[model samples]
Target chain A: MTTLPTPGAVRLGLVIDLDICVGCHACAVNCKEWNTGGNAGPLSDYQPYEAQPDGVWFNRVHSYEVGDGPAGQTVHFPRSCLHCDNAECVTVCPTGASLKRAEDGIVLINEDVCIGCKLCSWACPYGAREFDEDVGVMRKCTLCVDRIYDEARPEAERVPACVSTCPASARHFGDLGDPASDVSRMVADREGMALMPELGYRPTNRYLPPRAKGSGCSAHAKSPALEPVMPEGTGFLGWLDRLLSA
Target chain B: MHPALSVILFTVASGIGYGMLMLLALFLPLAAGPADRLFGAVSLGLALACIGGGLLSSTAHLGRPERAWRAFTQWRSSWLSREGVLAVLSLVAIALLTLAWPILAAPVECIEMTAAIAGLLSAATVAATAMIYRSLKPIARWHNRWTVPCYLTIALASGGLWLDWAGAATGVDFLPRAVAPILVLLAAVVKALYWRHTDGLKSATTIGTATGLGALGQVRPLDPPHTAANYIMKEMGFRIARKHAAKLRRIAGGLGVLAPLLLVIAGGMVPALDRSAVLLAAPVATIGVLVERWLFFAEAQHVAMLYYKADAV
Candidate 1:
């Protein structure tokens, strides 16, 4: 169905721990390797081993300088399709090529019907969608759709290529819709958050915020445990407390 | 946001085409012109060609033009689909009016009905085209209140300039000539307001907010994800230099608004040059709208840019 699934549906997604990620881009590389040969195979590269090598990548890792002065930190951010509940990419499609699976909440494009309008790319705030120049169609993260459901593969290996390949074990894949799920528990514990919440895409994917660095926060600098003095209802600890109690 | 030539031409041409068709629809039914077979054929034929050619030009940019028919099936959700459906329907309605023009000796009741339908459909299609851009919340410049009004007025202004000439050629010049200048002025005012409104605004999404790291003092892109420019950057990171945009905006205003307004007024005041002045104004106004249309895409800052080096999208 093109419309969003009701809340509390099986919203399968990722939880990336920013603190642990080393910015190695192993996930990105492995993603390209596995997906290029998978269902959405032969991900096009325009000029490989040439002046400017360009291709379609479902995942990208960016490094950012967070905070300021000595308190500032370098944070590695791996971006991909968040599989937003209100997936703008799906609705903007003139052809019914882009669809969000009502059962699992995975946003997908039926390439056969795809006219390659590229409007889906624009609708995505995360820059997740990539247009294949060679194929002349849009390609994006399928959340390792082919491998995820394959009963033949070993249970451990059934996870997404990115999650399975993360060197630091920073990336995770599970049902985020269930608070009891491992990924959802990780979100509650680490105070993971979505990117650009103001836009209201309601992305299922969560990013575990990087810990405080330098002299940014005295409480964080001292220890991960114990509370800093903030309002009773504020900060991650308070949020976690509320989640745990509820 | 890359300003593809095909899209620029499509918007400019179709905009004017629809504009002219709308005016012709009303004028034909009301007997604004002689309603002779030759004048009907030439005027309606010219309008249809512009609209048809412009619509065809749009398909050239599609990655898979062969599957464009599938675009019509999703009008329930997509504005582009709605536009596709409307464009074809308006074409059929206009084509009917065009066919009726040369064949029918007298004004038929069916002609009046068809013209009304054509006019509404043409107006709706043009509005839908504007909505295609205006509905995109990621593009702050396009999603604003000013976009639709700017599109509608500009279309009328540019299309009416030629309609004035056609009216004069068919022995009824006064009405179109008078109205074209007013439309030009209204379009100019709207265009100016749109520019002014967007100038002070910044894309709501910032790099910090995009990364969900704003609360962490300051944030900046340290290492880009890839060495090569990705699809997002290539497509959405298009930035025009300030001077160039300013210069083009002036050119658009001069040719599209001021020139057309003056020429149409001149066509009215100077009876000798009359229709010729209006004729000269049409292409000038179209080129102006063409440039403006290009700027529409070029100036739009996509929200995705916040992840890349953009401080604000």
Candidate 2:
């Protein structure tokens, strides 16, 4: 039951663009919001209103400074379940509850069948799986299965909540299994890379690396930095600003 | 990585159980007379009790203990499932062997054959348990070449100690006194070698490689996704100080290895202390193995922790 589907089966996953991701938690927040009341409802929050606020989040956006000082790039990396072609999380489920869909290759946990041994969580190298203490089951990104296939929802709205809500248009979702698919073409054009490919999870998701300096046609002609309001100490505030900038 | 009591107990206790079961099966053929049935009852009772207790404790940590039955279905793909299936099969074989404890009057061939099969099954069950950890690629400490050997040797040493103790008390040769010491030495050596090999070994995964951004430069987390510790952090991010781990290893070695070895050697030297020393060795070695089990989990660095600000896994 944990065996992956046919190799060419539609692999539904995300393509996150690192170039434009603004370190916004919108996707993660939207994911939690929709999923809290969606297929996996009431995503447990241990201490939402207290000094320590923790909850189950399907997506988590991490910001990293690659390099040091001014030369460094602030890359916003969003991590979640990749629904890999060779998902150890699915295979490691002792009760056969974690499985990759044969049709679309979306990995899912059959909560009813899950014994909640948490071995699946241990098996997952990505740290994608989260144990729901409230329900006594593991939870992860469902890819909005309920919304994606719902005929009642609009075509555009049928996408995953994270993809739908990304303000910077950094997230894209489609079937990567199809060579002719838009997602696949995007991968080719951008030279999108897989995270930790050496681990051999065969993660379905791709990440478009930040475009090289002076490579992609940028909106701004020069680096975005604040210039002194007045030339060379026309005001005390201006002088201070120039001094700080130096 | 969390070092949950349930898992530690399950491995240590069941290892002892399976080890004892296998030894008893092997020893049955060496029996001379009516003493066989009494030995069978006592050894089987102890082995079964340990196995049953350990199995039940494993379920204590499960989120849904009621659905644990379904775990047997995925033996084809899951090591955990295979462990479940094999543990049950081993129990059946041991039960049958115990119920139909070989009669001295009965033909020798059939009894020995069944005993061998039960012994093999018990060994296989222990292997499956080790594999549950060994197969995990993310936890480098568990997935290595040392894990299986460590488990097997530890089981044999612990179980052998018990058998030797039982045999001494009952004046039966369940396992040769010489054999238990050899196993104890082997276990001690293997454990020392494993520790030596793993000491200061850096994980292949690092923050830079994890994000696939090592080409750019060193990748350091500017901001974590959450301020509070999440489930992943709490589970996989367990940190044990070097000093703390070193002290525990010494404790485990002293109790599990040195104590048994010394007790056996001393008992051999002083025949007067032989019976009492063997009796004390079993419980003491079990506690040592328990401490060793705790250190096993505490020291393991899961690859998933790399993404959560761990410089390396």
Candidate 3:
């Protein structure tokens, strides 16, 4: 049951645009809010009001400063389950609790059967799985399966909570299996990259690189100032006539 | 890579248990009459207790210990499941051999055949356990060719010491006096080689490679997504200081290998001190192996930490 489906299946995944992401953390927050009430609910937080608070979160955003000084850029990377084609997490599950959907290729864990040995988490290179200590089960991003397929919700809004809630429009959700899909086209156009392709996970999600900064432009480039117009006369009518002529 | 106590205990105890069981199975044909029956009973009892206790202790670390039985289901894909199955099969074989030993006295061939099967199964069970860690490609320290042999050698060495102690206690020189010491030396050499190999090795992935940003200059973490520690940080980002690690390695080496080697050699040379020497070596060697196991988990580096700007995996 843990065996993966054939490659090039309907791999529903996300494509994030790093150039526009401001690291607002709205996606992470919305993920927590929606998933806590959805399939994997109540992502229990320990010591909520205490000095050290810990909890399970399906998605996390990591900000890294790449390069140095002039060429440096702060990259905010939001990491979640990539729903990999060759997911080791699923294969390493001793119980058949972890499964990859042959239909959509979304990986999921059966909480009822999961013994919570933490092997799946260790097997994953991306740190996609989250152990829910309270429920004594492993939790991960389901790609909002409930919302995405629910007929009750509006068709336009049928996307992952993280993708829909992103204020900066940094996240895109579509079938990555299709080469001609919108997300795939975006990836082709922008040269989207896998997070750790060297690891050979074949992650479905792709990240668009930030646009190269022009040599003349600075981090805080300002618009050029307009030349000052000399007033022909001290009167308002004369100033208006000079401004109109200019 | 957090060296959980339950797991450390499970691996060490079960390894020794399985090793002892295998040795007993190999020598089952020699045990005969009332005294030998008592000896076999006691030896087999010890093996079962150690193996069963260790297996039970492993479940204690699980979040849903009650659902542990389901772990036996996925043997095709999971090493842990295969280990569970093999452990049960070996136990069953040993049990059958033990129960039928007295009744099957007429045919020596039957006993030998059963013992052979049981011994092989025991060895296979230990191998399955080793593969659980060895198969993990994400951890550079554990996923290596040396891991399997190192585990097998250590198990045999520990088992040999226990067998020596048991033989000395029971006044039966069933095995050669030199066997235990020689195995201990071999285990020590293999372990040293494994350490040397891992020490010079570099992680396959670098921080830049992890982020797919190797084309850019040095990449560093400006800010972590969260100010507080998360599950990945707690589970995989465990770090040990170099000084402490060095000290622990010395301690493990001295207790696990050197002291046992000296005691076993002294026992072999002096007839009078044989019993006491082996008795002392058993506990000392166990503690050493325990420390070694702890270092194994604590030293492993998970590749996931690369996202946090870890210099290496």
Candidate 4:
């Protein structure tokens, strides 16, 4: 069961468009608000109001300055449990608390069976799982299992908190098993990529390639609808960019 | 990554135990002294204590202590299981040799040969323990020929220290003052090689490869798919303080290798200095090795670290 599942088969996944994301951090805040109030109560912050804030969070957004000069800029990366098919965390667990659901291909933790050893935390490379110090157990993103299947919630908003709250429509969720599903289609059209696939984790979530800032001919980059030739770079924007670089 | 005190104690204590016993066994090839029996017995006892206490301490890290025995059954494939098996085998070999001490002292070459065989078994068992780490291919730092030799050296060094201390207590010269320099030199070379090998390694995963788009010029994490820190980050994403690591490296090098080497050289040179000086250096060198081992683990960056953008960290 721990063997990695085939790509675009039994598992459902998400394809997030990073190019359109406004870095509002709505996904992270909504995720915390929903999960803490749902099945897993209180994500347990260890000094919420202090200078050094630390606690168990199922999702985290890291803002980074990736490059330098005119071609480089800031990028916001949000992290969550990958729900990997290989799932090393499951095998490393002394208890059977860590498991991947066969029915939905979603990895989950049974809080009751967990003993707070934190071995699964080490086995994972993604930094996805968080230890609930108060309860003495590991907690992670369940891909909003409770919300997605909740009969009480509206069917239209049944997706994960991060997916539903994306004001820029950057996040998409559907069955990756169906090649025609929204997620699958987006991956094919936008050239989506798996995070750390070489580790053989086979994570369910996919990250759509960041769109190139300018028009380019490479398949990985976005091609402009119509090509234009700039006249000796005389624009004010180009002048400012040159000045900044100088 | 969590740095559990019990595990640290378990590994360090057990590493010392097996390492000492292995060394004593190696010394058997040099000469079998009258006090060798006493040395063997004390070292065996300490090794057993370490193994037993270590197993108990390791249980503190398990979710279900009751399932600990299940690990032993998986030795056919698991390094963890092999480690357990080797620990038991070493214990058994020590027991067999201890029982045959009378036969060994009977002034018969045959009896001495049998006792020597037992010593070989003990050494072999400790070597097997070292191989457990060496066998893990996923852990690039652990999978190497040097790992076993380093472990053997540490074991011998620890045992020699014990024997020297015991001999000093009973007015016997178990470890000659001349032997310390050689031990320090060997240990230093091994440590240096391990550091050099691990330092020059490449990141296991690149941003381009991670996303399965090998042909892509460059791929950076734009919007990470989630909001919270999950299991992977808590475990494999651990990072150490660079400033403290640099300081500790100097401390470990000085104490574990350099100072010990100087002490041994000084002990060998100065006839006026008592054997106690050689004996004193053992504990000092051990404290140094312990700090060195701590840094070894703390400084090791797992291949999985690339997923967390640790290159930037």
- The CA lDDT of each predicted structure is 0.84, 0.85, 0.84, 0.65
Docking quality level of the chain pair in candidate 4 = incorrect
Per-model TM values vs. the true structure? 0.92, 0.92, 0.93, 0.73
TM-score per model for chain B alone? 0.94, 0.94, 0.93, 0.82
lDDT string for model 1 (B96-142, tens) is 87777666744566676777788889899999999888888778888
Per-residue alpha-carbon lDDT of candidate 2 for residues B1-313, written as tens digits (9 for 90 to 100): 8899999999999988888877766776776643356566667677888898999999998999998999999998999999999999988887776666633423555556666777889899899999989998888888888889999999988889988766766776667678888988999999998898887576667776678777778888889899989999988988853349989999999999999989998989999998889999989999999999999998887888888775646
Clashing pairs in 2: none
lDDT of 4: 0.65
**Most accurate candidate by DockQ:** 2
**Candidate 1: deviation at residue A145, Å?**
0.4
Expressed as tens digits, the lDDT of each residue in A1-246 for candidate 2 is 876567656888899999989988999999999999987787999879999898788898888888764457889999999888999998888888999998898889898898889998998888899998888899999999988999998898889999999999999999998879989999999988887787788999999988865432344546687875657655788789778989
Record all residue pairs in model 3 with backbone atoms less than 3 Å apart, i.e. clashing: none
Candidate 1 colliding pairs: none
lDDT of 3 by residue, B185-242 (tens): 8988999998999888876687776666656677787778776788888888777633
lDDT tens digits, residues A1-246, model 1? Answer: 344446557998999999999999999999999999999988998888988999999999999988776677899999999999989888889999999988788889899999988988988888899998888789999999998999999999989999999989999999998989999999999899888888888899999998765455675667866675664676898899879878
Question: On a 0 to 100 scale, what is the lDDT of residue B105 in model 4?
Answer: 49
